[model samples]
Target: MSVTPRTHVRTTALVLPAVLAAALGACSSFDQGTRGIADALTLYRPEVVQGNFVSKEQVAALQPGMTRLQVRDILGTPLVTSVFHQNRWDYIFTMKRQGVEPQRYRLTAYFEGDTLARFDGDDMPSEAEFVQRISRERKVKVPPLQATEDQLAKFPVTPGAEPASSDKGAAPSGAQPALSYPPLEPAR
Candidate 1:
């Protein structure tokens, strides 16, 4: 009976400390996390970022009287264009990276004769920004061209080798029809 009480006392003593240890362990982890966060706050440092950038204040100085060559010297070539309007040109300069000053420049040009008649400008966004805006604008997808059958064909395109296809659908080689076809439709 005495041994049973002593065993029970020892077991209770052992279990009580373990229960207390488990309870305290959780609080210690929270303390550790708080200390870790404090250490991170003290040791952490912010970084400075940089990117290719330009300012309009620089381009605004460009004047209407400036020639094509002079404009090229001041600003780089256009980014986008249509072949039909050679007179109109667009200039773009962009910057990338976060936590740093933005550097970007853009100019849309309209030329009269040889002189630059007018130009408009704004800051250029990063490549990421450019892609995001472009996506919103909805562009059609076009795959690059592979070689065509003509390019791969061993046969020559000479007149004798290839028969000409007339705009009108003519009958293949055969005896002439005994009856004439109906008359064509008249112009409106």
Candidate 2:
């Protein structure tokens, strides 16, 4: 038998790792119960945070210069409102999460000369002008009045509601100031 060269043996050993790495990377299917391994490596759950808005007060303080988007940022999207007047928008949010005091909200915004100027229905006003107009004598349905540490801790409204993210697994991990008025995007 011819003698095997030590150099040849070393070269063969060097290539063995690369070959195994390529083959393992290309293998997509596995013949075992290890499919759960991939799932365990990737898991996520959405955390839902509810708002506390007392209806019948905040809904009535809308003003002109406010766009449809601005209202959506504040009280969230409405359930239903007058379709005849496009300016009159309504927002409704559920308060009860799993049988804890059922929360219901309703807000109506009125317009003058085709521009929103007034509102009424439900929800407490958070604006100074609206607060001034509201009479403490009548029952005023409003949010927590002032955001608390707990309320702010969860579902804390960030300025501009923050832009929606398309990238995966990215989340703000701290309390952020609520966004100021964001200009309306041009209709595409």
Candidate 3:
């Protein structure tokens, strides 16, 4: 039997949609695969920093017989506090950044009664050293020192030079004068 022009057109119309649907379904998987590859090849990874950050100076300040409130004041709030363990506080810190090994630190502070008895954890970083480490990694530009003591020393100081007064012909303390202002614009 000879296929008519109408039959050919109907077959093509039905087959075309089926083929397109198959192609579109395949494209979705291909798109997902490409996304996976792109993600794998991505160079920029966001730095993941979490939990309570305790410094060496803060830990050093934590002496025996110190109150829980005092410990919290020095080292900030604890990251982990168990309901079961009423006298224990856990401080955990983790840092994950691109092109750097992940760092994890855990500190456990045990309390006897209401006072902090002792603490055990990895060695902490000093405030200054921690600042330097973070700044160096982020490539932050530090401004140069301006008008240093040596630079200021070059200028001779005038004898009996009174400092400049900020309040020029101002009212005396505890004086409440009359209040006046321009009328407010009417609301639209």
Candidate 4:
């Protein structure tokens, strides 16, 4: 059968995508098993912090024969508590940061009667260590907390100062004397 221009166009259109697909497939093989597109385009994975973060300090503070209330005060609250296991309190912490390896910790506190019998769990990091572990090492230079003199100079403080009159060398119309204020900081 003689092919018309329309048929030729249709044939080309169909073959073009197949050829492109094959080309793309071959290109992907050369990616060395790396995530080609996904690596280039970043997806936002939120910083997920789930469950109770029981620090070493908090865990250290827990003592045998401590009351449940006392344990709660030190460790905040248990993440998991089972009705079947009424005497056991589990503090599970999981932190999934973007670049850092995900962290999971479990601390189980066993209670005898109303007092803590014993507790055991993974090695918990200190509050400072936890902070460092979760924090991203950004090269940001944080500005000083104390303001510079120049910055303070911009807003010249005049206690109860009135607006200047338009007329030259004229006493500010209906202007009252400046009222003094107590020092911002109390005397040491």
What are the RMSDs of all candidates, in order?
Answer: 16.7, 22.0, 6.3, 13.4
Tens digit of lDDT per residue, candidate 1, span 6-31? 89999999999999999899899989
Instruction: Choose the strongest candidate by TM-score.
Output: 3
How close is every model to the real structure, measured as TM-score? 0.33, 0.29, 0.62, 0.56
Candidate 3 local lDDT, 1-188, one digit each (tens) = 99999999999999999999999999999999899889889877677878988889888888989999998998888999999999999999987867789888889999999998999999988777667656536656668878888899998689966544589866555557659866699667
Candidate with the greatest lDDT versus the true structure:
4
lDDT of 2 at 137: 56
Ranking by TM-score: 3, 4, 1, 2
The CA lDDT at 158 in model 3 is: 90
Go through the candidates in order and give each one's C-alpha lDDT: 0.65, 0.57, 0.85, 0.89
Tens-digit per-residue lDDT, 10-120, candidate 2: 878999999998887667445245678866665553223244343343444345557666665655666565668566665544443332455455556665544467666
Off by over 4 Å in 2: 1-77, 124-188
- Which ten contiguous residues of candidate 2 have the minimum total lDDT? 45-54
How well does candidate 4 score on lDDT at residue 139?
44
For model 1 the local lDDT of residue 135 reads: 53
Candidate 4 lDDT (Cα, 0 to 1)? 0.89
lDDT of 2: 0.57
lDDT of 2 at 101: 50
lDDT score for residue 58 of model 4: 92
- Residue ranges of candidate 3 with Cα displaced over 4 Å: 1-44, 136-152, 162-188
Error of 1 at 87 (Å): 1.0
